[model samples]
Target: MYAATTIGGGLGTGLLSFYLGIGVAALLRTMFGYDAWDRDFNATIGYIFGLVGWLMGVGMWGTWGREWFGLKIKDPHANSRKELGWQRYFMFNVDHKVIGIQYLATFLVVFMTAGLMAMIIRLELMGSGQDFISNKTYNTVLGMHGIMMVAVAVAAVVGGLGNYAVPLMIGADDMAFPRMNALSYWLVPPVAVTLLLSPFLGGLETGWTAYPPLSVLTDSAQTFWNVAIITFGLSSILGGLNFVVTVMFMRAPGMTWGRLPMFVWSMFVTAWLALLYTQGFAVALIMVTLDRIAGMGFFDAERGGDPLLYQHVFWFYSHPAVYIMILPGFGIALEVIGHFSRKPLFAYRYAVGAFLGILGLSGVVWAHHMFTAGIPNYLHGPFLVATELISIPTGLIFLSALGTIWMGKLWLRTPMLFALAVIFNFACGGVTGIFLADVPTDIHLQDTYFVVAHFHYTIVGGEIFGLFAGIYYWFPKMTGKMYNEKLAKLHFWWMFIGFNLTFFIMHWPGIEGMNRRIADYPESLQTANLIVSLSAFLLGSSFIVFIYNFINSWVRGPAAEANPWGARTLEWQTSSPPPVENFLTPPVIAGHPYDYGVPGAAPHVTFFPPAVGSPAGGGGGGQ
Candidate 1:
C-alpha cells in the first residue's frame, strides 16, 4: 500500500536508526571512558538519528534532502499528487490546501488526545487526597495535558488556517518553497511520537514550562521531552521562514502590504515572531539535553552555571510565544467580524499597527513570568510595567472588534457567534492578566489555580475560540460542503457556557489558596473542587457535538457556493477547494478588500482587466 511506503516506512526506518544511534553513542561513550549503557546519552543520540531517518523515509530525502549531497531530486515515490479526494490528504502533496488539511487533522487528533487527558485530570480532582490516581500519575497527566495543548495552541491556527488561506488571500499559487513546507509538516510526526513515548519512559514530572534545576534533575523522560520540543522548534522555524518569504515576494501584482487582508497581516507578524524567538526555547532545552547526556552544567548549581539562566532563556521565547498563539486568533476574530458585521474594518491601519505593536512588545515582557522566580528586585517593576504596556496594543485590537460591530449589520452566523464571543472572553482574560502583571498581586497568584484559570481564559478563550471561528468561516471554501447550521450553533453554545462556568469558578478556589499540580488538598477546599470538576466534565463533553458535526458534515454535507458569505477577499472569489493553481486565471487587485458600500464599489479583485468609465470599476484606474 502507498501508506506503507510513506508513514509506515518512516516509522520502520526511524526505529532502526534510533537503535543505531544508541549503538553509536555506546561506542563513543566507552571510548571516552564513560559507561557503555547510558540511557540519557543513548536516547539523546538515538532521537537525533531517528528524526533524520523519519524525514528521509517520508520522502524528504528524495524530494529535498538529496540536494545536500548534489543528487537529483524527484517526487520521492511513485504516486502522483494529482490523485483526487481523501487520498491526497494522505499523500505527500505540496499543494498548500492539502498540507493545510493535514495540519488540521493532525492537530485535531492531538487536541482531542489532550482534552481526554484533561478529563482524567478533572476526574482525579473530583475526590480529595489522591483517591483516583497517585500523585505521580496526576503530575504526568497534568504535564502531558499542558504540553500537548501548548502544541495545539502554537500550531493549529497558524499551521492550519494560516497555511490554507494565506497563499490564496495573497493570490499566490503555492508557498514559495513547497518542499520546505512539506518538510515542516513531516517533522511533526516524530515529535508526536516522541511525546507519546515519554509516559512509558517514566512520565513527565515537571510542567510544560520545563524550568531547569527541577527539569535537569528529574529522573523521568526529560531527554525525550527535550529532543521532541527541539525538533518541533526546528519545524516551526522552517515554517516561519517559508511564510516570511512567501508573503514578502510571492504576492500577486499590486498586492502591496497596505492592501493585505487582516489574516495575512497577522500571519506575517506571527511568522516573524516564531522565526525569531522559537530558538530560545530550543537552545535552552539543548543545554538541558547536554546537561543530561553530555554532562554539561548549563543548569547544574554545583557547577558555575546558574539555574536562573534557564528561566531567562526559556521565558524569552515562551513569553513571545503567548502572542504567537493569540495574534492569529485576533486576526481570525477580526476577519470574521469584518465580514459578518458588513463593515469595512474600522481603523484598519490601527489594527495592523496593534499587531506590530504586540510583536515589538512581546519580547520585553518575558521577565514578568519570572516575578516569583527569585530574580533581582530591580528587574521587577520594569517587567511589570512592560507587561502592562503590551495591553495597550491588545486593547486596540479588542476595541477594533467592538467598533466593527457598532451599528453594522449583524449576520449572526456560527462563525460570527464565535467571533463575538472572542471579544467577551478575552475581556475577562485581559482583566485577569492585569492582576498577574502587577507585582503585588502576581506574587500571591503565581503557581495557583488562579493562574490556571487566567491562562485557559486567555488561550482557550482567545486562541481556540478564534480557531473555531476560522474553521466555520472557511468550512465551505476548504471542504466544498456546508456544515449543519443547527448542530454548529448547538456545539458553540454548549462549549461557551461550559467553558465559562468551569474556568470562572476555578478562579475562586485558587484565590482561596488552592495550589496547582498537587493531587491532595485540604478538606476545606473540597466543595469548590467538586464544582469545578463537574463543570469541567460539562465543558469536556461539549466536544462530542463538535466531533460528530465535523465528521458528518465533512463526509456528506451539501455542496457549497464559491462565495458563501459574499465577502470581498480574494479567497472567496475562487472555487470551493480551489484548483491546483488556486485560481483558473490570475487575480488582479482592483480595490480595498473590505470596502463594502461605496456607490460604485470596485470589486476587490478581478480575473481580467477592467475598462474606463465603468461604474462597477469606479474605485480603480484603467487596469
Candidate 2:
C-alpha cells in the first residue's frame, strides 16, 4: 500500500512538471521567435527535463518492475530485513522513530556545512577590510550562509526532532501518513546538496532574500538556488500536511484537545503556518524562475515587471516563515519548564491562544520587513499596527515561562540552563524586534546589524536554545542513554557566553551604521569587528563539547528509565528508544499532560500498564 502511494505521488508530481514545462515553452515560442533561444529559456527547459526524467525513472522501477530485460518478475517479499542491511535508511520505512533519526542526522550535516560558511565570513571580517576572499566571493559565501541557516532553522525542530518525537508524545504508532513523512525527509538531501554546490554554478549574490532585478542578472547560482528552494518548500508542505493530519487524527484514546502536550500544540501551529505560507514562496520562486529562464518579465523592472512585486510575494511567506521557526522553540521551552519545575504549564490556555494569535499576525508582519523598500507611507501604518500587536501574544509566552519558574524547583540542568538562556536571549531579541517593526525606527535599522542581532537573538537564542533544551530533555527517550551532566552544563555555559559575546556586540555596530552583507568595514569600526570575529570563533568552537558529549553518551552513558523527568506525558510512559510499533499495547491517557499537582493528590507517576482495561484517570476517553 505504501509503495503504491509513493509511486503514484512521484508520477503525479512528474506529470505536472512536464505539462507546466511544455506550457511554458509553448508560451515562449509563440511570443518570441525560435531565434530567441536565450539562457533563461534553456535553463527552464533543462529544469523541466530533469523533473520529467526523475519521474520517469521512478515509474520504470516501481510500475514496470523489470530487473533485467525479459527477466522473470521477482517477488516483492523475497528480500526482507535480513537482505536490506542499512539500505533501509535510503528507502521509506513505516517507523516514525527511524524517520526522526534520519531528520536529525541530515540536518546536523547541513548545519555543520553552513556553520563553516559562517566561519569563512568571520575570517574575512576579522580585520578592517576584505582579506581572505574577494568582495564577490565573500558575498556569495554570506548568501550561502544565510540561506543554509534558514534551511537548518526551519528543518531542525519540525523536520528533525518533531518528526521523531511528536507521534511518540501523542501516543501514536506513527504519523498518519508515514510514507509521506519519509518522502518529505528524503527530499531534503538533494536540495541541500544542490545548495551546497551552488557556488560552482557561479554562486548567488542576492543573499537568501533573492531580491529581483539583481537576482535576474546573476549567474546559474540563481537557477540552482531557486530549484533547490522549490524542492525544500515542497518538503515543508508535505511535512506540514502529515503533521496536521496526524495530530488531528491519531491521538491515543482519551487524549482530548485540551490534554494535548505543549510540544504537540507547537507543532500543530507551526504546521498550519507552513501549509499556509510555503506555497507562497514556492509560487514566488517559480515565477522568478519563469522570469529568469523564459524572459517572462514578472520581476524585470525595465520590461514592465515590478521589482517591488518580488518583495511583496517573498515576505508574504518569509514573515510567516519566522513563526514556523520560533513557535517550535516556544513549545520546547514549555516542555522543559513543565518537567524541571514539576509544575503544570502556567497559563496553558493563554499559551495556546498565543500560538493561534501568532499564526494570524504572521501574515500582517511581512511588510515590516519591507519598510524601506519604496512602499507607500499609508501602507506602513497598517503593517506597523499589526506587527506591534504580535507582541501581545508573544508576551504571553514570557508570562508562561516566568510564571512557571517563579515558585518552583528549578533544576538548572543542561536543558534547564539552555531554557533560561532562551528566555534571556529571546527577551533581548523580542524587545529589539519592536524597533524593527516600527516604521520610523525601522528606516534607520532596516539593513543594519541591529536587525542581524535581533534575529540571531530570537533564532539562535530562541530556536537554538529550544533545540538544545529538546536534545537534553528528550535525548534519553530517543537514544536510551544519558548525556554527561558535567559536560552538558559546560557546553551550555560556553555556548551561552560565546553566543552573547558574538551577537550582543553586533547591536552596537548596527546602531553605528555598519551595513550588512559587506565583507569590508570602515577603519573606525576595526576594534569592534575584531572582537565580534574572535567571539564568533569561540562561539563556533563551543559545539565541540556538544559533539563529544553526544557521541560519548550514546554509547556509554547509564541506561535511561522511561520517565526521566517524571512528567505525565504519554511518551515518557514507554520504553526508551521505544519499540518499532511504539506502544506494545495501546496506551490509555490519564489526566492533563501538565498536571503537576492537585490538592490532596498523591505524587504518583501515571502509567497505562497493559493490564488496566479502563482509560487512565483524567479526562474521559476520546469520543
Candidate 3:
C-alpha cells in the first residue's frame, strides 16, 4: 500500500513537472527569442523521464506483475506489530503513532546536532574576542543553530506528539489524510540533511531570517538554505492541510466542536495559520533562489527589487510562524493546567476565542519584526496598534491559566513543574514583548540583544518549556513506562534556572546597545558576556539531565497504569502506549472533558471492546 501510494504521487508530480517545463521553455522562446532546445531544457526533460521510469517500475509493473503472476505479495492488512519494525521507519508508514515516534527521534537527532553548534557558539562567546574559531565559522555555527532550532520548534510537538496523540485524544482512528501525514514526515529527513550539509556549500551568514540583499549576495550555503527552507515550508503546508482536514472531518461520533480537547483545538488553529501563511515564505525563498540561480530580480536591490519587500514577505510568514510555534505550547499549558488543578479549564470559551483571535491577528502584526527597516512613520503606528492589540487575546491565555490554577488542587509532578514554569517564563516573555511591539521602544531594541533576549524568552521560554511539560505528561502514553520523578524534577529546575540565567541578563547587554549576530563585542562588555556564556553552557548542560531521565525511565522505571494522572480525558482511558488502532472501540463522549466535583459521577466514561471484559460491550459508569 505504501509503495503504491509513493509511486502514484511520484507519477503525478512528474506529469505536472513535465508540463511546467515545457511551458517555461515555450514562454522563454516566444518572449525572448531564445532557442527552444537548450542544455538546461534537456536536463529537465531527462529528470522528468527518470521520474516517469521510476513511477512505472514501482506502480504499474510492481502491482500488475504481483497480481497476475500470483506472487506472494506482502500482506497489506497484516497486524501493525510487524509493520512497526525498524525497517518500516525508513519507509512511509500510515500509522500516526509510528510517525510521531519518527518525528520525535528525528528532531532529537537534529536538536543534538544543533546543540553542538550552540556549544561552539558559547565557546566563541566565552570571552569578548574570538578564541576557538574564526568569525566566519562562528557565524556559520550560529546560523545553523538558529535554523535547526527553528526546525525543531516547528516539528517537535506538532509533528511528533500531536501526530501521535491528537487523533486518539479526539477519538478518531487516524488522521483524515494519513498518506499526506506520512509524506510530511518523510520530507523532514531530506530537508534536515540538506541544512546539515549547507556549510560544505559555503555557510550562510544572514541568520535564519535570510533578509534580502545580504542573502542574495551571500554564498552557496544561502542558496541551499533557501531550498531547504522552501522544502520545509512545503512539509508544513502538507501537515497543516492534513491536520485541518483531520480535525474537521475525523472526530468521533459525539465529539462536538466545543468538546474537542484544547490541545486539538490549538492544533486546528495552528494548522489554519500554517496553511495560509507558509506559502508566503515559500514564495519568498523561491524568489531568492531565482535571483541566485537564474538572476531574476524579485529581491535584487541592484535590479530595482526592493530589499524591504523581501523582509515584508518573509516576516508575513515568520510572525505568524511565531504563533505557530507557541500556540501548541499554549494548548499544552492549558491541558496541564486543567489536569493538575483537578478542575474544568477556566474560560474554555475565552481560550478558544483567543486561539482563533491570535490566528487572525498574527497576520496583521508581522510588520513589527521590520519596524526598523524604514517603513513610513504613519505605517508604524498602525502596525504598533495591531501588534499591541494582539496582546488582548494573548492576555486571555494567561487569565485562563491563572484562573485554572488559582483555586484548585495543584499537582507538582514533573509535567506540572514544567507547566508552572511555562507560566512564569511566558509571563516574563510576554511583558517584554510589549517593548518590542511599541514603536518608540522598538527603535532602540530592534537589532540588539534585547530583541534576541525577548524572543528567546518567548520561544525558548514559552515553547520549549511547554514542550517539556507535554513530553513529561505524555511520556508514559508514548512509551508505557513512567519517568523518574526525582530526575525529572531535577532536570526541570536545572533547565529553568539555567535558561533564565543565560537569557535574562542578556537584556542588560541589549540595553547597553550590544548588537546581535556579531562574533565579538567590546572589551567593556567582557564581564557580562562571560556571565551569559557561562550561563548558556549551564543551560545547555541541563539537557544532560533530560537525556538521563528519558533513557533511564524508558528502560527501568515502573510501568504506568492507565489514567495515572487521574484526569478526565479520552486519552487516559486507554492503555499506556495505546493499542495499534489507538482505540479498540471508539470512545463515546458523555460529559465535558474537564468536569470535577460532580457527586457520584466521574468526568469520563470509557467504552471498552468486548475483549476488554465488558459484557455489555460498553461501560458508562464514572471512574
Candidate 4:
C-alpha cells in the first residue's frame, strides 16, 4: 500500500514530506527575517510542516482527508486486514485490530529506546562524579528518558491493548468512529519523532515537568518538547473520547453497564479522566511553547510571570495523569485476577464505584504535588487530606484482588503471576505514597530519591507489571499464538527480583537525603547507588528475555485455541486473533462478563458464523 507514488505508505514518502516541511520552514524564515540562519526558528517550522506533509504522504489525505472535505471515496476502509501481509501494519489501515498492533509495536520500540537512555543514566550514576558523559549530557539523557517513558506509560496499554480489545469486548464490529480512531493513532508518530529528534536541537534538560524559568531559558530543544507534549495531549484526548463513546453506545445486546468487563470499565473511567484533564497540561505546555517561540513570558518571573503559576496548571493535569496511567492497569489486573482465579471479580460494583471515586478525587489532589512549593498554609491541610483520601479507592482495588484470590483455584499462569505482583508492587508504592502525602514527611522527603522510589514503585512496579500482565493474558487472543510460558516465568522472576533490589534499596539513599536529578551524590551513597545501578542493569536486561520470547513466540509458537482461558468476556467468544468484523453477527450478551464460577450460566456472548450466502469472511466488516 505504501508505494512511492504521490499518495502511498512508504518511508520515502515520509522523508519527502519531511524535507518539504524543512524547505517550507526555511523559505518562510528567509522571507520573515534577513538573518535566516537561526536553527531554532527553522527547526520549529520544519517540524510542524514536515508532519503535515508526512500525513499526506502516509495516505491520510487519501483516506480521511477526502472525508474531511466531504468528498466520497471508494473503499474507505481498504487494506485494513492483512491483504498485503504485514504491510497493513505500516499503512493507514482503519481496522481497530491493525491500529492496535501498530500502536503496540510502535510504543514498545519507543520503550526500548527510552530504556537504553535510562541505562546511560544509570551508568553515570553507578560511579558518582560524572563517570563518562558530561553533566549537561546526563541531564539531557535523564530528561529524554523521563519524557519518553512517560509517553509509553501514558499511551501504550490504553492506545494499544484498549483499542484492539474494546471493540471485541463490547461486541462491536469496530470503534464508534473508526476513522477518528485511525486519526488519533496517526497523530502519535510525528509527535514522537519530533520529541525523539530533540537531541540534535541541543536536547531538553528541564525535566518532563518542564518547569518554567529553567524551561524558558533552556535551548530551543524545549520548543520541540513543548510541541510534542501538546500534540500528544491532543491525541490522548481524542482517544479517550473515542473509547468513551464506543463503550457507552456499542456494547453487545443484554450487556448492561453492570455486565461490562472490568477492563472496559477501567477504560471508560480512564477516558473520562483523559477528556476532562488532559487539556490542563496541554494549555500549560502551549503557554510555555509561546514563551519559547513567541516571547510571551507567561512563566518568566522577571517579566511579571509567576513561576508557581506553571506548577499549578501543570500539576492539575499531571497528578490526574498519574491516575490516567494506572487506572487501566488496575482494570487489567482485576480482569486477569478474575479469569485466572476462576471467580467473578470480587466486589465488582464496588470496584467500579471506586474507579469513579478515584476520578472524582483525582482533581482535588493535584495540589499535593505542590505542597512544598510554598502554597498557603491553610490550603496544605486540605490538599494533604484529599491526597491521602484518594488512597481509599486505591485500597479498594487491593481489597478486591485479595478477596477474589482467597480460597480460589489460583492458576499461577504468567498473567496471574503478574497480576498478583501488581498488588504487591502497588502496595509498597501506595504505602510510601501515604507518607509523601503528609506535609511533614513530604517536607523531609522532597526532591529526594525516596520520591523517585515511590513513583517507580507505582509506575514501573504497578503500571509496567500490569502492562506485562495484560500483554501475557491477552497474547493468545491478540496474536493466535502461545508465548513461551517458561521464558515468560523467567522474565517475571528476573524482573521482579531485580526490580525490588533496585528500587527498594533506592529509598534508603533518599532517607539519607540523596537529592534527585543530580549528577553526583555524597560519596557515602556510592555503594548504594552502585547496587541500585547493577540491579537496574539486571532489571533492564530481563526485558531482553521478554523481547526474544515475544518475537520467537509470535513467529513459531503453538497455535492458540479460541477462548484459551475459557474467558467469559465477549472477546473470547470470537475466534482467536478475532475475525475482521470481530463477530460474524452482533454478539448477544447472555450474562455478567466475569461470572466464571457461576453454575449453569450462559456464555457472556454467543457468536454465530457468517451466513453461507453472505459476504462471510473476506475481511468484510463495517465501519
Best by lDDT: 1
Candidate 1 lDDT at 547 equals 91
The order of the candidates by lDDT, greatest first, is 1, 4, 2, 3
TM-score of each: 0.96, 0.88, 0.88, 0.95
Per residue, candidate 4 scores C-alpha lDDT tens digits across 1-623 of 34334234434566666667667776776787746555555566666766666776667777767766888654746766555666677777788998898888899999999999988988999986868888788888888899889888989989999998888888888898887788788788887877888887787788898998888788748887887788789899999999999999988788899889899999999999999999998999888877776679788888788988889999999999989889988989999999999987799988998999999999988888887899889989999999988888888998899999998899999999999999999999999998899999999898899999999999988888988999998899889999999999999999999999999999999999799998898799999999999999999999999999999999999999988888888888878888887877767887887777689877677655556776445442568
Better of 3 and 4 by TM-score: 4
- Tell me the whole-model lDDT of each prediction, alpha carbons only: 0.89, 0.81, 0.80, 0.86
lDDT of 4 at 587: 73
lDDT of 3 at 194: 66
lDDT of 3 by residue, 1-623 (tens): 55445545655655566566656665676677766664334333433443344333333333333555867544322324645455455444667887888898898788878987987887887788778888778888888999899988888888987898798888887788765687687667657766887787687788888887788777547876776688789889999999999999888767789888889999999899999999989888877877775668988666788888888888899999999899988999898888899877899999999999999899998889878888877789899999999899989999999999988989889888888888888899999999999988999999998988898998888888988998999999988899988888989999999999989998988989799888888888788888998998888999999988898888888999887898888888889988777777767776778777656654565674546553253222367
TM-score of 2: 0.88
Error of 1 at 427 (Å): 0.5
User: Residue 417 in model 2: shift from native, Å?
Assistant: 1.3
Clash count for candidate 2 is 3
- Model 1: clashing residue pairs? none
lDDT score for residue 113 of model 1:
97
Clash pairs of candidate 3? none
Local accuracy of candidate 1 as per-residue lDDT tens digits, 1-623: 66657777788888899999999999998998988998888888998998888888777777777778988887532333556446667666678888888999999999999999999988888877778888788888899999999999999998899999999999998898877788888889889988988889999989898888888889999889999999999989998999999999989877888889999999999999999999999999998888887779988888889999998999999999989998988999999999899988888899999999999999898989889989999999999999999989999998889988998999999999998888888999999999999999999999899999998998999999999999999999989999999999998999999999999999998999999888888988899999999999998999999999899998999999999999999999999979777877778887888887756877789875433443241221367
Query: Comparing candidate 1 with candidate 3, which one achieves the higher lDDT?
Result: 1
Candidate 4, residue 67: how far the Cα is off, in Å: 2.9
Q: Judged by lDDT relative to the true structure, which candidate is superior, 2 or 4?
A: 4
